[model samples]
Target: MLKKGLYGIYKGVEFRITVDMDNNLKIMTDKKEKTDSTFEDTYQSGVYTKIVKPNELVDCVSVTPFGIIKGEKVQILQEKENKYQVATGALLVGSNLNLPRIDRDSWLGWVSKGEVKLFEEITPINPEDL
Candidate 1:
């Protein structure tokens, strides 16, 4: 299985893999929960959200590296209370190259839930289609 923060093919579908750090390599996917569910009740595995607030600058938990602005995409790695652990970077799935070093340009840190909105619902690609 692909390690956390790495992008790879799983069951013929491309996914930016993440795992529950507290769990034993439990792979996280881009599946979202039903509408009625609350944040705590929702499965936050590989959920991806995009910055929606215009001109907004999201601050990292620790030292501020750079600004995360509108329309930037981030994957939800984990959720705690009102904040989410998100990763922002480019997708390397269909590049046709060996998996490069994890997240050369990625940013991983906590962001408030209000900074982002649900981008899309990811569905695994059909194996036969490949």
Candidate 2:
């Protein structure tokens, strides 16, 4: 089954992110531990989830909103019909860049093996800064 959360690393720190149907991203540390709190002393409760620093960001394409696909810097323009449109200044990585069944093994492999340096860092500008 596909995992609900994405495990990734931004800079050097590890993080897990969940994107809801509305595209709201919730980033937290990838680790979790049982807490002292419990429900009726039977069910575990209150697991700790850490949030990313406001200024820090991850580079993994699977988790990042911006990326270099087919050599062009692109941002996710739309998501429909189980496909995504990633565009870069009128150019696009084409529809194939985003697929309903992503090749998670290859993508995650690149992330884990530190092979992402071959692609340029193309994080999009946050409008809030302007």
Candidate 3:
């Protein structure tokens, strides 16, 4: 049985497949939910990266309106053609100190492949320790 909140493609068109409370399969378009199907698991690891400088603005696929900032960290969720679906923090609504760090609150959107790069961590080494 097809799982709810998962994405699938049929007749070359992408769709968000969902199972209704009555167990009926419902296919919706242009809406991204929790896609956990193997068909959508194409990305290698949940690749996390930051938005490139001079941030390239692109229309987001979300229920709310917002803007992405340069250097903001995001997790690459899926990729289609030249675009990548990413998950990032939503707009700060209250005190920054009390911000919740959870997946349920993450903002999911799409970004061009050129607007992001794979993140790399660098560590300094002392000559004496070398």
Candidate 4:
């Protein structure tokens, strides 16, 4: 079980679970702030705060550079070294953990609409490495 600020993968995406000074649990996703309505709405739609185990709400997964489309999993190779291709929900690393970037693109669109069972283990990653 993790305490306070930590990052975990939820449904193939990364999320930061934070405990405020007041002890209120806050689940944060990439690009969405606590104050964002989309964030609040997504948070409200799930249950994780009551669980004692971090895995109960999230998991750790490898950085999947490829994803499936239609029926085949395609690799998301960058057209150039260190180039950004705008992947929605692509697990990104930087100043903070980032979720895959979702947009109107067909590939990204497929990822955003996909679902994983609550607490389902996708890819287990160490918190420190996150």
Tell me the lDDT of candidate 2: 0.37
| Model 1 CA deviation exceeding 4 Å by range | 1-69, 90-103, 124-130
Q: Please give, for residues 24-60, the per-residue lDDT of candidate 4 as tens digits.
A: 5455644532233334443665433321244445564
lDDT of each: 0.39, 0.37, 0.40, 0.39
Report model 3's TM-score to 2 decimal places: 0.29
lDDT of 3 by residue, 1-130 (tens): 1122333443344454444455544444432332334233225444222211111211212222222335565555566788666666655521222333456575566667676664422232221121
lDDT of 2 by residue, 10-125 (tens): 45755554443555444543234321222122234423343344355545334345445455444444344444444433412333444232343321111111211122333433
Clashing pairs in 1: none
Report the poorest 10 consecutive residues by lDDT, candidate 1. 54-63
Top candidate when judged by lDDT against the true structure: 3
For 15-117, candidate 1 gives per-residue lDDT tens digits of 3433344432222244453111321323454454221221121121111122232556455666678766666565542122122335666556666767646
Top candidate when judged by TM-score against the true structure: 1
Candidate 2 residue pairs in clash (backbone atoms < 3 Å): none
